[model samples]
Target: MTARPPLWRDLRVIRAAAQVAALVAVGLLLYVLWFNLTNNLRRLGITTGFDFLDLPSGVNVADNPISPGAPLRRTLLVGIKNTFALVVVGIPLLTVIGVLVGVARLSTNWLVAKAAAIYVETLRNIPPLLVIFFVFFAVILQLPPPRTPLVFGGLVVSNLRITVPWVETGPGADLYGWALVGGLLVAGGVAWWRTRVYERTGRPHHRVLWAISILGVVAVAGWFLLDGPIRPSLPVVDGQRVSGGFSGLGAYYAMLSALVLYTASHVAEIVRGSILAVPKGQTEAALALALSPFQRLRHVILPQAMRIAIPPIISQYLNYTKNTSLGIAVGYAEITLIVFQAIGNGRPAPQSILLLMGAYLVFSLTISALVNYLNRRLRYVTN
Candidate 1:
């Protein structure tokens, strides 16, 4: 055989050298940018460190009260908490609405399908910022003032705020909380056992019912045994303000409503496309087995469709989380708003912006990681 080319003259060596040169060039460019940025900041008399985080943030956060002398770190934590609150509530609601609309678009009923189509087209086409403005100005601000707050049972609604009845934790609540966690673990075990049983015996598995019943029994028992660890607290109007229960700022509601409607429109389209991508033969097979429409969907269609939909759904979730930054427009005190507030109050803009970007990057990466894990679990295991 002919002698192999010298290592220095090899194609692989040339490719490796090219990659190293490119990386070095990119690093030099970044270093130059950093040097210029630091020089400019120094010339402008701007301090460039995170030490400011220890100083007090004198701004008032709407709906969440922090002491005027509270540290900037505390203020940021509150902002993060507010953002998490939106994500926690918004994701599930969007999922429910999107799934409903998506399925409706495929419905045999002409009106239902057309209506869903219109909803998806109308909301998705509009700018999300415009949606936020519409909800804030046209819907939320139009409600009656606190003095004439609408009262329905345990809920109070007004242009200024909305309040709903919520569970109030009392003494021994910590013990009951731990007990509830234990109950959940037990319920999960029961679900796993039921699933295993179904797998082994090919029997109908009512895993959901089993899990719910187990959890409910433990919860009720714990509630009584721990001597009422929690009780319901209803909203009560106290003069110009509402007290008791869980209160939501009008700005919070506006941001949440707009993001949910806007994001759900996109999610609906994703779901519809994923459903269509599922094999037609699967639906036929379910029908031949005499499965009802709902059963066919739940057992055969949705499971497969979800695997396809989850990747794009992850993108929608990230978009929703980022769009929350637009809450600044409506005066919501999300992280971006709080950071900008700090900057306006003489905090270093560069550092505050860096922190803000880091916060969002963390959120995006976390969501991506979680969805990727689920995707792997749901992915097909082909031979």
Candidate 2:
């Protein structure tokens, strides 16, 4: 066999050719996109620059407290905050509920398994927007109007809003902060102590109980020392309005609940599949060792299952974050809505849309990065 060309020479030529071809393709694609964008903007009399971002976004953002006179950038920021709020709150709630439902679907009880199965099937089939509408109309709007709100102690649940107690910040704020710091230290100490006890005796460690007791002791002591610095901001009925306390507007609750329910269905499926993917031998081994189902799930099955579950669950989370834009349909004033409003009110459509896309892209990539880190940490490592 003739070695016509040395390996290095041949590889170098191939690499050079591939790089040139890839660069040509990328250049052409960018050229086309730029051309189309500028051509369209000029045709529509819209500026293609970032200057529009400085213009006042002259529209009242419903449910947002920001002034309409604020710059377009501020409006966009408020919208981003609203979107982030939904995702941050919804993700944890959905994940917990989904995990419970997924586990229930595997329960020995016929009723529980079937009920969980029904919920997953029903929810996953429905369109998310319809679910949002249903939640808003049937649950939120159907409640008694703001005048005669449902009251349970300091809490008031109304058609227009739900109000709950919020501690009014007082002069003893520093005391409360120190109490929180003390609680953290105490909780950490309790956890460390529990670990030591578990190591020494190989007994069940009630780490949660230990941590809670420590934190509770610190908090209760701080409460008395602070001399009732925090008090209830109760909701009061004022004619046609419910005032006082922190209110969750009907649209906010509706949008959050809808996304949570929708995302939970997908998360439930992922949990079920991940759990099932865990080796049957692991479950059997736990049983052979006389482990209770809860202990087996907690210690043996879940750790393994979580490795499988996290990647897909991360995707669901990203999807939920992106889906928060759907809140615009119900007037929830999320990022997408604000972008559209800005464009309508003389902000350049191209630049505003680009910014909106960039925001979502950043949110998605950040979530992916976090998930990748967790995946690396959890992945099986063998020497």
- Backbone clash pairs in model 1 (N, Cα, C under 3 Å; residues 3+ apart or in different chains), count: 0
> What local lDDT does model 1 show for residue 289?
100
**How well is each residue in 215-329 modelled by candidate 2, as lDDT tens digits?**
8887878778888667666777687666677877788899999889988998999999999999999999999999998999999998999899999999999989988988888
What TM-score does structure 2 among the candidates reach? Answer: 0.90
In model 2, what is the error at residue 125, expressed in angstroms? 1.4
Clash totals for all models, in order? 0, 0
lDDT of 1 by residue, 106-137 (tens): 99999999999999999999999999999999
Every model: Cα RMSD to truth: 1.8, 2.7
lDDT of 2: 0.87
Q: What TM-score quantifies how close candidate 1 is to the native fold?
A: 0.95
Q: Which stretches of candidate 2 lie over 4 Å from their true place?
A: 1-12, 193-210, 380-383
Give the top-scoring candidate (TM-score).
1
Estimate every model's Cα lDDT from 0 to 1.
0.94, 0.87
User: What local lDDT does model 2 show for residue 93?
Assistant: 98
